[model samples]
Target: MKKEKGLQKATDFSGIKTIDDLHQHLKTNPDDADELGEHFITKLNNAYAEKNKTESDYEDLLVALDEWEEKPEAASKIRNTTYEANYLIIGACIHNHIVNNICFPGVTAIQRETGLSRTTIYRHLKLDDFRPYDKLIRGKHELMAKRALEHLYYIGVVDRNAGALKTFIELTGFSKKSSASNINNYIQINNLKITREELDQLPKEITEQIAELISEGLQAKDCDKKMEDMTT
Candidate 1:
């Protein structure tokens, strides 16, 4: 009987031969940068698969990459033509934790690993830009805020009487004044439960005074009744 053939495994381009070869390949196949990025991601996943990489490792990488990218020598090496190479470097840097900036490497570490100067790495980072990745982070914070607000509403932590503006301020770390202004605008735009008039009626000073009094052990029921009478 004929011997059965084994399945062929994908070729690992991980062992790139030379810098020139890498430059040429990236120059020739610009679109392939995305594929190279995926390859780098796979490499990272495999590397961290067995042992969990610490937060410091990821942070160090970001700092290293940040420093490396600013070098003039780095820019001149990849200058103008190799989008694939640029994308590959960035993809590797931000692979698993795109939303987490801590995953980025510092310049010295990146240089040590890639054998490239800081400038070259810097150029690569700026090539396609990481703004889209940054947006992912901002989007995450926004989602969290939304969920927190939903929870507050569900558990009666916030209600028509106790507006979500305070919770939004606490969760978002925005100042009470700014948070109120922003929440007012948001409520107006979305036509949410709170109205502009209601928000305007309770000035920041009065709300703060009420909060202070409540914190001082004043009866909340009496305070609420007083606030209602004052507003009316």
Candidate 2:
């Protein structure tokens, strides 16, 4: 407790590296065991805390790497921590949802799959620029309707491959020559052409994941019923 009274060298020294190092220090210093026990415990606790952070960070990094391999275009995001990786994965989920569906999957759906906090997911969504699917804005913003145009392209209505479409007014109700030109710009910028699929359909992996979530929910319900019976 009295830091100033202790040996200056001992106090100034770097942290105890390992259990063996602590034992060596105790042997050479001949400190009181009861007094030194708390110090060693603190050091060990610090080591454990660092281990948890580094371990989780490595795991998140691996997941991020896998995602980057699949969608190499997103590798430009420059992330270096578990926190950043969480954002990256959430962004991927949002992008995938846009590619696969009419609207972004809600935060809870993303949470069920990613196990990230709602706040983290929401923060990533806030930085989203590709579309308004993840946003709360009610109406279509004409100049910024990239996702809508891409959806049309996928469905063969606004054919990017043929360089064809109905007028922007007939297709989207709001006429903008800029929207059509922007679609071409988007195709050039992202170098992507989404395969056509029914809007109601989900990818095979997502379908399996939904089934697993349902099974887990049913198991949790059974556990709750048993707990209620025990209380009664």
Candidate 3:
């Protein structure tokens, strides 16, 4: 594991895009999650030794690890990778599925559906499973999945995935042209203070221009002006 710490530090290269590049870099360094966990254990031992603190905390951590190893589910999860990294991959899978298939579900829904703890899901979305150390302390993963969806939305890959099931919040507003005839029908049906006789008394050209404007999404004022000029 100590060897892994060296590998982790040495392999961190910036500006690399795509997973293949990452795989190549990692292959050269060859560090795994076991090494990462062992490295953290060593650090914890050093800190406790320096402070001359009670070893009970370290002992408890050891016991926790032992228990986790015995648990079939946890053991399988951490088989070839670190607990954190595996958790991250799971979260990404969950996120992709939710966005692509089911409507964007909130954290509660995600938790209920995936049966993963909220903390783990948050950590995956926010800090990529707390790899770099500082991120673990920063509390950045709070609502991380939600933030990722928002990023996707701004990029136009996904629409509003919230508020109503099966209905995305429309940014373009109601279709004015599509509804104009319905609106006119409603106004006519209501018969508020005006009668068919009054509508009939209006000039035929004015009525025709109003109909055209309503159907074509043109402003009534512009339609009226155009009709008047045509007559002149």
Candidate 4:
């Protein structure tokens, strides 16, 4: 029970938008690094999954913005603060750019693409820690579980829509199939080595799932452990 409280406390990375914020946090509670990093990974993963949801790039962001203006309370897709929304949106841009593009686009390009000023992009992205920069006020874990489904598409185990399914799984625990049984039924498995930088092309949540699956069939190295080892 006490652990849950500490965890809940640790999850609050609201103000941590910059690497300097992370540095200050480390100075005070150096021990929380692992937990902090885990939260960071979770945040990025959530944002990435959010990025994947829309078939098109920043178009949905504009739609979400319109919804917010009409009814802030009903803007389920947008974040609370302007900064928070920008952060998530920028994270979406970053996640989208890095994975989808062969060449990395500069912040200036990101500004043009998302209609966000370069300053806004810099602020939320200055992260050097695990503090979550949330865009969605609710449904974090359910969102993250969806990332695991992306592996199905990556590995050719399922169609592209597979990644959209994890919202139904409880992050607390789910009685899904074994890691191996989940993917062996398919052909042309994408190499899911956790150590490969390509794995970073996927969100940490999906990477972790891939690691678990690959670990069983082949003597895959403890790459997934490395991926989950947020302390470092």
Position 230, candidate 4: lDDT? 66
What ranges in model 1 sit over 4 Å off?
Answer: 1-14, 17-21, 27-41, 51-134, 153-176, 179-232
Superposed by TM-score, candidate 3 places the C-alpha of residue 25 at a distance from the truth, in angstroms, of: 42
Question: Each model's C-alpha lDDT?
Answer: 0.47, 0.46, 0.44, 0.49
lDDT of candidate 3 over 133-199, digit per residue (tens): 3333234565664576456444332222232211111222222222333433222435564333464
State the TM-score for model 2: 0.22
Supply the TM-score for candidate 3.
Answer: 0.21
Identify the candidate with maximal TM-score. 1
Which candidate comes out best when scored by lDDT? Answer: 4
lDDT of 1 by residue, 1-232 (tens): 9999999676456554344444566665655554554554454344334323222232233233323435544333222223344345546755634455555666666655554445555655574553333433455678987787767644433233334434543454333344554633323235445444554577887655544443333346657888999999
Backbone clash tally (model 1): 23
For model 1, the local distance difference test gives 0.47
Point out the worst 10-residue segment of candidate 4 by lDDT: 164-173
Cα lDDT tens digits, model 2, 62-119, are: 3343343454333233222333555556768778877888687898878765666555
On residues 1-232, what C-alpha lDDT tens digit does candidate 4 reach at each position? 3544344433576776555666676677767656664565455445545543222223233323344336545333333344455656777877788888866778787876776655456555565331343544335655766675555434432322323223222121232332433433222447633322343356868845754454342333444666678666
Models 1 onward score TM values of 0.31, 0.22, 0.21, 0.26
In terms of TM-score, how similar is model 1 to the real structure? 0.31
